[model samples]
Target: MELGYSDSVRENVEILDVVSASEEVGILDDVINQGESEVVHLKVGMKFDTVDEIYELYRKYAQQKGFPIKKRSSKKDNGVLRYICFACCREGKHKTDSETPLQPEPTSKFGCKAKLSARLDLDEKWRISVLVLDHNHETSPSKSRFWRCNKKISNHVKKKLLLNDKAGIRMHKHYYTLVVEAGGYENVTFEEKDCRNLVEKERHLKLGEGDAMAIQSYFSKMQKHNTGFFFNIDLDKEGRLKNIFWADGRCREAYKEFGEVITFDTTYLTNKYDMPFAPFVGVNHHGQSTLFGC
Candidate 1:
């Protein structure tokens, strides 16, 4: 069956015009309408006027129950949505990193069976058809901050961070101001490191083309000289260099022998660019400090 939006949905959106701008980024902390009558209690026969309404109801329910939700699947008929499914984030298994056996496996998925399915009815309303609420793992609302779905950096906040950076305000101070204005760290959706990353990105963009190109050329030369040389460069949204890391043939060989315990330190700054200097260090057989990579 095909679906259509009801006029009441548009009217409801107009009535909710007073929502905070931060909500435009993603799902915010307070998602449900506060009215006691608006509480979401999913059932097989529950219906919604719009697909967004159904998703909002399910998201609010998942947040309150201390779990994350994601759109599992959807079906469309004649370019119109006919069926949709929402399920716990930990509903499937993740692929293993067989190439890197030492790397730890992800613990997010547990074959969770909790899900809700809805179908468009002849009357155009979405009615729930399947509801499996049992979870294979425990849930806690207190840990909602860690949910990727709940963590968002709104555009308003991004602009504020950028302005503060240009004004020479330290990132920690500005981050603290945001936390205080929001009432506490718990109230803030993002962490201080997130703001630091933004500032670092801006600094990276300020790097001159000569410096970035020179660094790339050096890496290319080294890779050509030694086949075991490996490197990775991170770029910003605008395709500018954000960061880079490299390891020579010797460093990779040292890692194969002393990779069990390695240390990464970034306490120093480069003399020319003033960028943070990090080095990977390992202990040798003679108890000497050996360079792994940087």
Candidate 2:
């Protein structure tokens, strides 16, 4: 057998020495020493044909067990030897392929059959409380329908009622006031004063109908104080209003101060030609006439 620098070669050499050598006869030791030298010679004497014969024998042994050794191209360092596992047939790195079948799941040691269950509950006590409050308010005679209570007063009373009888404090006070004042009638009638005062205290203030009418009358008085003339007139050559019933009264007054009068025909042919109609008036200064038409 040819020997190379491998752990198997070393093991074989040690085994040979142990088998041949003995304490009584040194002849076996001599034989072992010669055998080691012969092993080196055997390595140098190995031919390509011998290697091929040994490989074929190894291949036959491997085939019986299903392992197949494949040889790759030789490199400067070492020849590549691909070893496939006999049972798995996976090659390289001694690992199973990623496509390998999965193992089965394990069964439970103990079996139970109770289904899970759950439910939710909501508090509905507020509905009853609201009904009780409505009934109490409707039955109470002392509750005023005309007068609205203030929030500050009601809140204070509610707290007192809660302290005295907590069950009765469930209903909130629901009424408020809206106050209206008269402009020139700040002193209300005795019968309406309490309602008006309660209204003024609780809600937005507003002007009453009487107050609005008074305001309008006051503005009218102010306008009259600044008024200079009440009517307006415009005259052309005729003694009639120029454009309409209302005209420039200032121009008429100026003409009146100069004692100037105007006259002209107040009639014209209508579209029907049978009716006498006039749509405008004119003015005459001395003997000259100027007409203003509608």
Clashes (backbone N, CA, C under 3 Å), per candidate, total: 0, 8
Name the runs in model 2 displaced over 4 angstroms: 1-244, 258-260, 269-294
lDDT of 1 at 236: 73
Question: What TM-score, over all chains together, does every model reach?
Answer: 0.53, 0.13
What tens digits encode model 1's per-residue C-alpha lDDT throughout 1-294?
844658866544432332223344432323222232345588899988998988878877886788999999999999999999999998998778567778767678999999999999999999999999999999997776667666667766777677767756667766665664566776777778877877676665456557667878899998999999999888676656667889999999999998889898888977545677789999989899898999
lDDT of each: 0.76, 0.29
Using lDDT as the measure, which candidate wins? Answer: 1
lDDT for predicted candidate 1 compared with the true structure: 0.76
Mind sharing the TM-score for model 1? 0.53
lDDT of 2 at 163: 40
Give the per-residue lDDT digits (tens) of candidate 2, residues 111-171.
1211111111132111111000011111221221111210112333223323422222112
List the candidate 1 regions with Cα displacement exceeding 4 Å: 1-40, 94-104, 197-294
